[model samples]
Target: MIRFQHISLMRGTKTLLENADATLNPGEKIGLIGANGAGKSSLFGMLRGELHADQGEIDFPSRWRLAYVAQETPALDRAAIEYAIDGDVHLRHLQQQLAEAESAPATAANGSLIAELHGALADADAYTVRSRAEQLLTGLGFTLDQMQLPVASFSGGWRMRLNLAQALMCPSDLLLLDEPTNHLDLDAIIWLEDWLKRYAGTLIIISHDRDFLDGVVNVILQIDEQKLKRYSGNYSAFERQRAAQLTLAQSMLEKQTRQRAHLQSFIDRFKAKATKARQAQSRIKALAKMEELAPLRAAAEFSFEFRDPVSAPNPLMVLDDVDAGYRIEDSKGTIGKKIVSGINFSLQSGQRIGLLGVNGAGKSTFIKTIAGDLPPLSGKLHTGKGLVIGYFAQHQVEMLWHDESPLWHLVKIAPDTREQELRNFLGSFNFPGNMVTSPIAPFSGGEKARLALALIVWQRPNLLLLDEPTNHLDLETREALTMALAQFEGTLVLVSHDRHLLRATTDQFMIVADGKLQPFDGDLDDYRDWLFKTKLVAKSLNAEPSPPAVSERRNAPADTPVADNSNRREQKRFEAQDRQRISALKKPVETRIKRLEEQLAKRNARKDELDAQLAAPEIYDAANKETLKTLLTEQAYCAKEIEQLEHEWLEQQEALEKIS
Candidate 1:
């Protein structure tokens, strides 16, 4: 176990944590979460010994090996695989010793040293280090060919993947990852989730991706109110527990407030009377002894909505037999390379779409073409009248002038708008007071992303194209964006790895793969299954063929059967029929599952309403006893119904899986 005994940490003049104490058990997967600038990374720094506590102490097993992703990767000519292999410092040292021993002059001492080194290498499993490194790279979305390239050849994002691979490659008792999925696509994020689930060590992660944390971590360590608060279970569980705590705290505060008011009123009314003077004084003493309950101060929430577009055409845009890709011009002539071809898509008003694909699978190319950032290589693209597009990507965040204030950026776009109005608008996005006027150079990535989004909302475009908009946002901001997108009265095309955002905001999905774009037949869960099956098929196709058995070879006929082709065709037909049959059987089960899920959601919502009512002090008053009783009865009923519905949902899902 790792223990923090009254730990207080400071970053210069600002206190990040004060009198914080927590214990982390071995092999616990902890999700370290907090708002932006809430000291998540600082806590990690303290654990890594790059920062120290200003008071008290932190104690853990000194011998435990710790591994964390490096913030920067030096440009080097070393092969990517070799760089990952270097993460295992002990194995590399052993290999070096073995090489040096073998190269020395032959002697008894040298021979003994060589033998010992060989044994050490074998124990370290140094020979298989390359293969393990390759697996790590592959899981992180690196292709086989790219693994052999020099580290300096890759771009900045790929370099970050390499750094993550290196950290994963190391053998450690404790692992710390900060936003590991930030640079990953959906496919890579899923892979990392599975990998982290199987990791048999103490793991701590800081991530804004809620689904990723829910799928990987078993415990949540939140940095709130300058303290380290630990909660059992995953992100969802933490949310439930935190909500309960907040409800209870608010209830207690309200009750205390009423008690204090009542006592004060009594003392005020009777303190001057002779008969009630003693009683009033006694009441005043009681009031003075009463502990003051501070009001619960919730974090400032970010909330904004997309202003209605000036005009919305029926069909915002249309791509007729379009080839989406880049056009490269050389000295010879212009050349077009198709990334995704034959895309016949229509962007209708109020359509919400989520784009799904692995890394380098043309998702960006497709989005860029729609955003008019790139001209189609071929085919006609028809735009509806009064079409206005608000496109957001990482580049938009980067395009913000670092020297300018948030107010200044808004003013540039809405030049004629009053300064006070612009400032008020910025406040809705959580940029208030000095933050609105301060230079954004010192802003965090989350701040930059929020600013970029604020600029987009100001445009009020009829069609919005957002690519990974939640990349640098915290959970609160992401939720705000989700709500905004859900309520936006316009067409939306989003490419993101945040599953929660995708599920909540998009009503349909399209997949980009194999140089083709098409509608995905199912939801995110189905997409996960599709990815798994696709990988399996690819692996089997790439696997080496085994030799024929000797007996089978001997039994082979010299002459071919004349009906062989017909028989094979008949077999394929039967297989197709079987697939159709299974699909037919699955349809009703899927429908039931969907219906059950809807019921569960409704019941859960009602239960939440009941819970909120129960938390209010007035609900428990004598006059409202009947109402309180009714609420409790409904809450109980909702709970039972939810349980039954969930069970049915699970059964239907299992049936569908079995059919598949």
Candidate 2:
């Protein structure tokens, strides 16, 4: 358990937290969230002991181990799995100590030291650490071939994944994850959510992804007005609770206003009639009744609205047999391989389509082709006359002048537009007062994203091509964007890992896979089902299945086969083969499961023995104080080890069941 009593903290000259009181219980998974610059990472620093509170005290056991993802990775020549295993500081230290002891002569002193080190390593679960590290790497989307490669061989994004795997590899009482999904694709994100769900330690994660937060966290710690506030439940629950409170308060004032209108109408109706005096008396009483209801002074939600396009294009673009992807050019100027082929996509006015597929499946390539940022490799691409596109991608945020303010960036987009109008628009996106002039270079990723959207809305585009627009946006900003996109009177094509955003904005979905771009005639639920089956098949066969052919791509479910006896017979034959292969595979898994069950039983029995011994009043005697402490410590350690083993056991069970 951890407690903060009337804590206040600062970063440089800015107050990050002031007079905030909160307590975090054991095994609580908390989502630390706020708008950009609200000091989420600062609070993490305080917990890790790098940042001290200006006032008040933070109370926690000094021996509590904390695990956090490293922001930077060295260009090491070490194997990736070896680097991940190195995160287990205790295990690594014990190994090094044991190695030194074993190098010395086999004296009594050396022997005892070696034995103690070996015991510590066993307690830390050092055995099979390499296999565990490899599992983490695989979950994060690294292939087995990449596990033994040098860490220096991977790119920055892959390095981030390595860092996350390393952080998860470490044993800790508390785990801190900061935007762990930023570098992950949808599949990897799903895998990570499962991993986090199984983590028994207290988890504090900072992320802008609402869906991810809802899946992993049970509580929210929000930073606002220089204070940290705790809210019960997941992100959606918090939103609902907050909304209900706001509604009730506003409804009181609305009720009074409606009563006032009713009274006035009665008075007006009876003013010239025989009941004039009675009506006036009733009106006065009703007006007095209004005093009981408090005034509703709640601040309005900060949101932005996209303006209607000046001209609506019936068909925004037409891709006829398009081959979308980057073309390789050399001295000979010859075009090379295409990523997506036979893409017969048509974007009509008011169409909202969400792009879906695994990472590197050419979703971005198709989007770039439609946006005219990239030309098709070998097909006719036609655009309607006077087509205006508001293309929003992560790279667009980077394209802005680093030294410019939000106001300055807007001015560059619309030079003739009034400055006040631009300021008003930026204010709607939460860039108000000094923020309008502050250099965006110093802004957080979320703030920059908001500004980028603000710039896009200024042009009143007829079509919006957005690729992960909600990547760094907070819940409020994401909601605002969702509302805006839902109401936008234009064609929209979005590529996002944020499912909440996709559900809110997109009316249809398109899957980019196996070199084809086609409609996905199913909702998110069905897509998930297909995804699970696809992964299971790939795992069983040790290879990826190809996508449907171009001719069979549209107007039906992707998994559907023609209703014929021949196809049915072929499907049944393949299914039979899969079942036979799976049954053979399950033998080893079942054997391992049985062994783990036996080990768990033994551990539980020992724990019960300790529990009974600790329950005895004689164990608490003054002479047995050290004995009591040892038993308690060992009990806690045993519980954690068992919990981890149970989690591993479940994963294996799931794999076996997926095949079945």
Candidate 3:
């Protein structure tokens, strides 16, 4: 067990943990959660012995081995597998000793040392370290050929995965991982979740991904009000318990407020009266003796809605046998090689789609093609009229001007908008006061991501194309984004490894694989099963073949006729034609439904505006009798028009559904 007793921690003058206490039992998988700058990482530092508590002490087993992912990876001309194997310090030491013994001149002592080292290496299972390291690498989305490549050749994100693999490769009593899934894709995340579930050692993870936490951690430790609070069960359970506590606290506070108010009123009314002065004095003393209840403070609270688009055209874009890929040009300037080919898809207004696949499966390529960052290599790409797209990718965050402030960025995009209005918008994204005007170069990755999203939302786009939008955002910001996306009336197509976000914001999923794109007719769990089955099939194909037994041969079915293949092909072609015909038939109805929805939105917006006008006290004055009458008449008209439009919209929707 690990224990912290009266632990007080401070960085500079800011108190991060004040007299905090907690106990972590052996083999417990703990999740450390808090807002950014809330000292979750600082606590990890203390546990690793790199930092000390300002007061009191932490106690744990003295002999326990600890392993944590390195924050930085140096550019080394060494095989990736070798770097991962180096994580096992004990094995490395044994190998070094064995090498030294083998190098020495022949002698009885040297021979004996060599034999002993060999035995120790065998005991440590050092011979299989390469295979184990490769397994780790594979689970983290590394290819077989890439395992032997130099560490210096990989990109930043790939290098982070290497560091994580190194950490997992280490033999330890306790393992610490901070944001392990940030660089991973959905498949890799699922793989890591399974790996962690099978791990026997104690684990502590600091992550903002709710579903990931829920899947892996058995306990949740939250940093609230400068104290370490422990909760049994996973992240979801913690949320429920915390919500209940907050509700109870709020009720008590309200009760206290009412009691204090009543006592104060009594004293104010009778403090000078001869008969009741004594009772009033007693009440005053009672009121003075009451303890003040502080107002409940949420960790972080801010939300901003996407502006309505100026126009919403049905079928926002269409791809006809398009090839989404990068140009493979040299000095002579050749056209692009196809990463994904024969892509025939349509993006309709009000559609919410999630894209899923393994890493390097052309998900980003498709998104870039749709965002107009890349041109289709071979076919026509039709964009709808008045189409306004808000495209967000990781590189968009990198494109922000480091020297400029959030205010500057907003002003650059909205030059006609007032400064106060821009500032208010930035505040809604948690950039308050000086933070809005200060250079964003000093901001964290989460802050930069929020700024990028804020800029996109201000554009009033009809179609939103987001690729891994939740990468650097913390839990609070992610929740806010999920809420905003849920409420967005425009079209949304998101590619994210965050399952909670995808599940919350998307209604359907499309998969990119084998140089093709297709609809995924299942939820996230089914995707996981599919990934597992795919791996099994790949493994079986790679394995050596074995001869069939006599009984198995007897049970095998006879071969079909050669003509059957042609017949099956014809059947598939006919099915494809039927699907196209149905889609063509549905288009008109879908268009009608979209137009009706747009009209309803406009009318509802106008009705809201009129309702706000009618809420004013001046609208009821006698001097404005004629104005009031006109307002009333218009309000009634709006109500009736809204009713009729809603009915028509519902009918159109039903008609469209029937066609589908």
Candidate 4:
């Protein structure tokens, strides 16, 4: 267990945390949530003893091992996973000692050395060290073949994953994760959630991804106005409860203010009366003693209003067998390898479409092509007459000058747009007063995203093309954007991984698979469901039946008319038998699938328990410690079962397809 008692964190002249108290139990998943630069990362540093607290100590058991991921990049050379895992000098020394002790002859004089070696081995969890390393690497999205590849060859996101993999591989009493899901895709995020669930340690994760938080965390530690507040439950539950508390605070303030006003009125009317003078004086004293109630300021609520799309009778954009890519600039405009080719698609007026594909699958390139940033190779492109499009590219936020404020940017969009009104609008996005005046350069990634979005919406273009619009938005802001898009009567072609946002804003999906764009008549969830049913579930339903007996007696009827009553009756009976068999087989497959899903859920719960236990040094003792080798064997068997279930599910789906 870990607890912060009367902690205060200050950065220069700014107070980031003041008298903040928070308790995190083993197996308790807590989310450290706040706006950008709210000192979430600093809190982790303080807890880990890297940063000194101004006024309090972090209480935890002695000899506790804690791991943390900082928001800033750390210097690391490109190395293989194996090398990285074993690179820690202290751990390597322990491993060497263990190896030496293993080779030494047994003798009474060597007893103490052997005992010391065993303790070191236990501390290192050396019995299943390799398996732990492998699991951590795999969970972080590394394939077996990729484990030995140089980390330098990976992208920034992958490098971050490698860092995360190292943290998980270490046996720590507590895990401090800050925005771990930022660079991960949906699949990788899900895998990490499962891994954390099974981790036998305490974890405090600071994240802006609400979905990820809800899935893994059970508690919320909110930092607001340099104060800390604790709530029991996931992010959603905490939010609901927080809102209720705010409402109550407002009501209490209103009631107290009303009482004060009534007392003032009485004093003003009765103070002149001779008999009521004493009573009035007492009322005055009461008024003096009465505490003034100031309501807690409500959290920001953003409302995005887009300009009405220009009404056009024709489609806004079209691409015909075109190839799109980033071209090297020379005297000539186009010169580069086409990243995506043979793309054929069209965007019509009033079409709300979502672009779905893996990252770097040419979605951005295609959008750039439509925006006229890149010319298509060997194909024609067209835009409807007067098609005013607002495009938000990946680097759209970079266009804002560091010194310019939101109001300044608003003025650029429209010369006469009121500064006060623009400030109010920015305030709705949680940027208020001096924060609005602060240079864009100091803003957090989420704040930058909101500012960029605000600028784009101010343009009021007829066609809105957003790429990963919800990239850095919180749950509330993302929802507000979704609502705005839903109410938007214009063409919206967006790229997003947020399931809720995609479902709420998109009407159709354009799947960019294999360098080709194909329009599907559904949302992201629906597409996922269809893919699962067809590819995973269907395979389970169609197992082969026993081979049919070949006989001359059966062949004799090949040319014969089976329209006779007896022959027809026999054929009907055979058909009914086949139907019954198929139905019976399907029932068990369905049941097995359901059971496997339930088992997965149970495993997740158990994993969470393990995480809590591991996070507590008391729960993790060298004396009563379970053998790492035994745990590894059990974990491996469970992992194998999960893999087999997935494989069998796929095969079952294939069998079902054959039967159909």
Among these predictions, the greatest TM-score belongs to 1
Ranked candidates, highest TM-score first: 1, 3, 2, 4
Better of 1 and 4 by TM-score: 1
For 489-589, candidate 2 gives per-residue lDDT tens digits of 89899988788889999989888888888778777766765666566545544666444333322323336675898977766766666567557657656
- Model 1's number of clashes is 0
Give the CA lDDT, 0 to 100, for residue 577 in model 1: 64
In model 3, the clashing pairs are none
TM-score of 3: 0.80
Provide the lDDT at 3 for model 4: 79
RMSD of each: 20.5, 9.0, 26.5, 11.2
Task: Give per-residue CA lDDT, model 3, range 192-235, as digits (tens).
Answer: 99999988989999999999999999999999889999999999
lDDT of 1 by residue, 230-312 (tens): 99999999999999999998999999999999999999999999999999999999999998987899757777899999999
TM-score of 4: 0.70
Per-residue accuracy of model 4 over 50-107 as CA lDDT, tens digit each = 8999898789887777776534334445454664475344577876876786578855
- Local distance difference test, candidate 2: 0.82
Q: Specify the highest-lDDT model's number.
A: 3
List where candidate 4 sits over 4 angstroms from the true fold.
70-77, 83-93, 96-146, 298-303, 323-342, 398-440, 473-480, 519-660
